[model samples]
Target: MSNEFNDEFVKEIPDHVRQRLDQTYEKIRFQSKKKKKHNIWMRMTAAACCLLIVGIASTSEPVKAAISGIFKFNDSGIEQAVNAGFAEETDQSATNENVRITLDSYFSDYNKIGFSFQLLFEDPTLLSGKVEWISLDVRLKNGDGEYIVEFIPDTKPLYGKSDYSVGVHVMNPIIEQKTGIAQFDTVFDSTEGNFPALSNAVIEVESINVQYANGEFKKIDGEWNLPLNKAAKPFEVVEYVARESDKIKIVKANGNPTSLSLTISIDGEPTETPFAIMKVVDEQGIEYEAGSTNMTVKKGYTLISTTFPISSFVHAEKLQLIVGNEEVELTKTND
Candidate 1:
């Protein structure tokens, strides 16, 4: 959590790293903002911010520190992130009394969304030890303002058991333990009832809460919203009939460099395991881990989704979704 690499040390960027940063930064900067603000203020929190800029050119101290945060700051491994998906951060900030939370940068595909945030507790003493538990009240809406996923802890009692007992923690327990200034990475799943790709999603952190083993707790109650362009490729979605029932269908393979996943749809409750990976085979007989299913049940057809840490894959040449020994053709992979 301590940043040994200062901004001064990062002043001299290597030619290769600089080139990669520029390429990624420009593409994201020029992305059509008719949707979301992929605009400015992607400034890094510390010298580690340089990681988002340098693109891992070497084994230097700065590169290692930043890359190590890939998992802490994101749900997927850094090696799995697509180089093209790197976006210039459009930070969204909100302050409540002595607490300030900044939504650093975020990205989304069909079902998975990831974001990084920096929290500054003006009253550092309020936090005494390691953050033993954490959770958020998230509300997501589309362009027409339809509620896509609304889990408000006040009305419902879900997402309330995020315990941080060492191994079961969310963020890097080591880095997140400290008070005052700290950063965290998180992801949200949006595939429900085999719904089509979202046009645009506006998600708001209605509230954030954290707890410690030492009976200490802290929270910031208010809206910390960010708009996301899913970059959804509707035509690229793939379909697979379920092993359990024909009515139950596994839909779409949405992916970027960092994460990949598919959605399952069925009437009533779904019987398929949501966390199991759907093995994929390519044209050259190459194999890749597509996703481990994560799901949510709804009124009509229950839907499921999951993501993998496959960083170097964006789209597949020819792919197949394998559940057990059964194989299904995926005509197009999401980009």
Candidate 2:
């Protein structure tokens, strides 16, 4: 079971722990805003930092009514979408080495997929101190047992810093001081057209490796393969007019309950500005956060598809898809 804390629970946490959490949160928000919109490192760092906050905060509970719940995303838009039942809920549990891991929630929109996991320790003292890092050897496959996603951590140093690696798609989990339960989220890389049908998908976690603050390491190896009951709910393709620039044309811009996908056709020569790095803004000039992004070169024009966390556009009368300096007007036909 997980400990539930209220908004006032921060005061109960140790001063040092609270300070560290605040600092880490600030760092994550700053990096997320300053980096490229499609950078995967930002997502990984944000997830780890969020887990750190939750793990440490769960240690001290000031006697509140416990409620069942999972973690939340830092993005307000995505959080709202999740709250509105945009994600698939599940409670599949698997135990190994006295530790229980539960797959609580999952969501996918073809372009991107994300899921949350909760770990409960039988011996709470195992997570009594700051946990430096936790790595899970995770792989995903379709119903036919064909591998779809594999996390291969980079081995070489990234610009003389080995603590973090670049080009790694796995969202590594981080742990801090906690009592028993720790929850975290993971978003896979942009699948583009490579993602197979989501029906009956199986997620296998071969092992989980943990590194503690005191230079201690722990590895829990087991065969944990969980099956999904169905495929992700398909995104509703909102009506829109194709808009084009001298450099590119917006052929497809669709919206789902939690995300927006934009596909653009690059004209003759590639523009100096990369579409994947551009900001995704709505009609109100509000910029949404980017998820997984991929670019492909076709026979004539290059195709770039990037997903943004914009909640939904079903109710909106007028919307805009702004990528860099280019803006595409999207008018909802049924409106």
Candidate 3:
């Protein structure tokens, strides 16, 4: 069985693709300590990285057909929202220092905003060889000169930081397979609370730094402030009777129909934090899980909230919350 499994799967992966995967893993391992929590890194590897490798390596016709023509580097939640007409189609472009940055599109909800961007280089050979990583300094502001979001580091795992206005966490940018064009998505989530009704918000791109496999670096220094329209849509909230266990209590759930995202918040007296809730299964036993999660303990109460990109669970006849070894039933309020 082991020989057959590897002969069919492992040997099919191209040497170059394998090397790329190894490099990406090493990079993530090196950056994991400084940039992200260990759990977040684990989730990324499990969902994104693993799937990416398999999608690239798999020779099956069905697998190729499944992944073909999709933007390989997008958050599933935001992508679904965009598909459901919950995003702004902004084809705006600004060129600086030989690099053309285009804000291809964006989606915004109560607590987060995501951008899909493309970087085109005049020198087509800019991505000639192994590209290590690409980093962008992005900022968003409202008309009143107030910063809409800013990335914060080392916010506590349980109780989030309260002093900051909006602590935004920027996950690493992903590059598409095409040459001379680096298409990627970046999501900025508010750690403090939900975002306000924004108007006249403009995304500012200060600079972009790219590192190649040769250890040489290329930097683009300039500012591009592109106008953004529309305020974020409020999340659809559903109230529950608040069920409780010894350590955790289920409060309410927030959902977005367009994005197919669900956020479950649990509040109870602080005790041992439950293990990560990785997957959610509905009555039919179909599973879905995607999106970011965080917990907060405020005012002597612990609050754990996680968002998942499950479209069906919003209206599922029966839904269950699975965290660690604890499985709690979720009953919705009557319509």
Candidate 4:
């Protein structure tokens, strides 16, 4: 019985049982302590990272606020006014807006001629924004009834810088032709034309009226005039006869002539006068006539040479004769 009880007790208590229990307890305690340390380190690291992020966020806020403030207050009210003014100036739909006029040219017959102009505008700003549309009623006058010209912008969503160009045409009744003469006489006659044979014509231009932003119209006064002259007539010819008896001779030769003897007179004086012959030419050749001779009278005269030969004529039909700085054309007579 005693041996059986001892064997049962030994079987219940296996070898190394106590040692295994002790090692298991030690591992559990070490693991618990390690877990606690790891949790504490994680909390500390998270707190430090949060502090760094918050510090960066706090330091950057003031710079953003300062930049925003500079943009808000630095620009003067002038920029605002200018922007508004420009918007108002370009707004074609706006009533009583300021208009711009660029003068190109002026005509006198109650008509604006070659007049080109543009509306002006200023830069846009945060205060004034942009212009949308503008309208203006312009009147041009010169103590006569007012001539009207309107301007409107053609753009949509009116914004930024903008301007418009307007053209005006003026017409008057004084410059119109008379239709009565054409109906009365259809035949073409140089002396009885329907148009006025005016020697000279004059035109005048006066003032321009501009409407401002306040719906008030202002007068910009100016004057322009144009004078026109008639065209010249074609040239004509006159004749004079020479009465001298002395013979004329060409002494020197210079250039070719169209006629042998020129029937030209100097200051209405006949060719018989002892004029200083500068150049003479016949139909075939040119010769300079020089001699000491006197004139009987300052009236019409003829030239005949008793000493010089007549065969040296430069031209036969017409003669260009120069006497005492005066030039005249001489035609040969058949007689």
Highest-scoring model, TM-score:
2
TM-score of predicted model 2? 0.69
Candidate with the larger lDDT of 1 and 3: 3
Better of 2 and 4 by TM-score: 2
- lDDT over C-alpha atoms for residue 126 of model 3: 70
What clash count goes with each model? Answer: 11, 0, 1, 35
Ranking by TM-score: 2, 3, 1, 4
**Model 4: residues with Cα > 4 Å off, grouped in runs:** 1-278, 283-285, 297-309, 312-315
- Ordered from best to worst lDDT, the candidate numbers read 2, 3, 1, 4
TM-score of each: 0.53, 0.69, 0.64, 0.16
lDDT of 2 by residue, 1-335 (tens): 11123354222334554344343233322121232233322333332323333334443441121213433434444555678776787767788878777777787654446777766677878777766545565666667756555542332111221111111122223242444655555655341323445878888777676656665667677877767775666656555555466776877766655556666777543544465445555555666655545455566667666666666633455666666667667766663
The clash number for model 4 is: 35
Candidate 3 residue lDDT tens string, 1-335: 00012233222324554354444333221122322221231233221232221222122232112223222234444445555566666667788878788776676665456676667667757766666555565666767766655321122121222222222222223343333556545555443225555677887787775656566767677877677754554445443343666655665554443223333344444355456544556666655553445455455565554455543214664556666677666665675
RMSD of each: 14.7, 8.9, 8.5, 50.8
Worst 10 residues of 1 by lDDT: 160-169
- lDDT by residue (138-251, candidate 1, tens digit) is 655666666544434333433222211000112422223234555555444332212334566676776666555554555657766666654433233333332443543766
Pairs of colliding residues, candidate 2: none
In TM-score terms, candidate 1 sits at 0.53
Which candidate gets the maximum lDDT versus the true structure? 2
Ten contiguous residues minimizing lDDT sum, candidate 3: 152-161
